[model samples]
Target: MENAQTQLEINQCAGINLLAAKRKLVNVLEKIRHAYKSASPEFLTKLDVSQKAWEESLEADMEMKYPLEDKRLQYGSVYPMCASGFESRLVLARVEFLKEWLKGHQDGDICSGSIIHSYSIQRDCSNIGK
Candidate 1:
């Protein structure tokens, strides 16, 4: 729950440690890869990009999810899961943060973008892989 809580803090607060936050993302992606018993260097790059893009989008206060409205825009949804606008932007950015990163390729399919769940947490680890 440590990661989740920290992520929650990032989601709820206003701070842009994008690099460290991104490192956290890499760690989480690495953990998911290891937990799922899947590993690949290429996937790591893709995963890293995806994670970072999601972070960038968050830092930019934008949303990413299932193309919304019509203008051929807005993929996935926004964040905070409560208010709309920037609030939703954060929730969407943080939770589904890995979406666009993988949109460029399918090989590094990370999480299924499901609603954040209980079992999402695992034993904390620093190294994810290369």
Candidate 2:
């Protein structure tokens, strides 16, 4: 990106970055699915639903960010680059959010919700003060 000179080059770089981020997202999702394969069917279904909703939300956000129907005409030549870069950042943020399932939460945390406890950190937290 730093080496990109022309607007064309910059847009190309942004597209490349976006593709890479999407690949990372796919990999992270696959890891989560594999890790939680034995989880309840309802949990798996919810994960799928959540991912779909997030994608829809992201698209809506982009639409809101560039509300003009003729985005290219309104935003000019930099629209592609700017939009791609912004979308990449959003996708990377989503990847980080989804990673909570992989990282999990400490056992005995009441606020942990659906995230499984980190198996490596498993302990009888209730007995900690004993």
Candidate 3:
């Protein structure tokens, strides 16, 4: 983007960045699915449903951001670049959110829920009150 002097060039760069972010998102999601492969069928179904809902939410957010019927006409020439950059940020955020599943929580954390527990730290939670 440093050399993107023209609006067209900037817009193209933004679009390319957006595509890269989307690919990263796909990779993260695949890793998450693989990590939880041993989970029950119902867990997998819920994961799929959650992903679909997140996608719908993302689309709704984009629509709300640019509520006009004709975004290009309403926002002018830079609309494409802005929209692409905004979408890229949102996707990167989602990737970060999904990464927690891969990282997992400490073994003693009882609230870890479905996330795989990490036994790297051997902590005793039973003596917390003492």
Best by lDDT: 2
TM-score of 2: 0.87
TM-scores, one per candidate: 0.31, 0.87, 0.87
Candidate 1 residue lDDT tens string, 33-104 = 554343346655665586677658664554343224442233222233222334344544564554332222
lDDT of 3 by residue, 63-129 (tens): 9999999999999999999999999999999999887776778758788777776432113222222
Alpha-carbon RMSD to native, per candidate? 12.8, 7.0, 8.1
RMSD in angstroms between candidate 2 and the native structure over all alpha carbons = 7.0
RMSD of 1: 12.8
Order the candidate numbers by lDDT, best to worst.
2, 3, 1
Residue 27 Cα positional deviation in candidate 3, in Å, after optimal superposition: 0.3
Give the per-residue lDDT of model 2 (tens digit) for 70-96: 998999999999999999999999999
Error of 3 at 30 (Å): 0.5
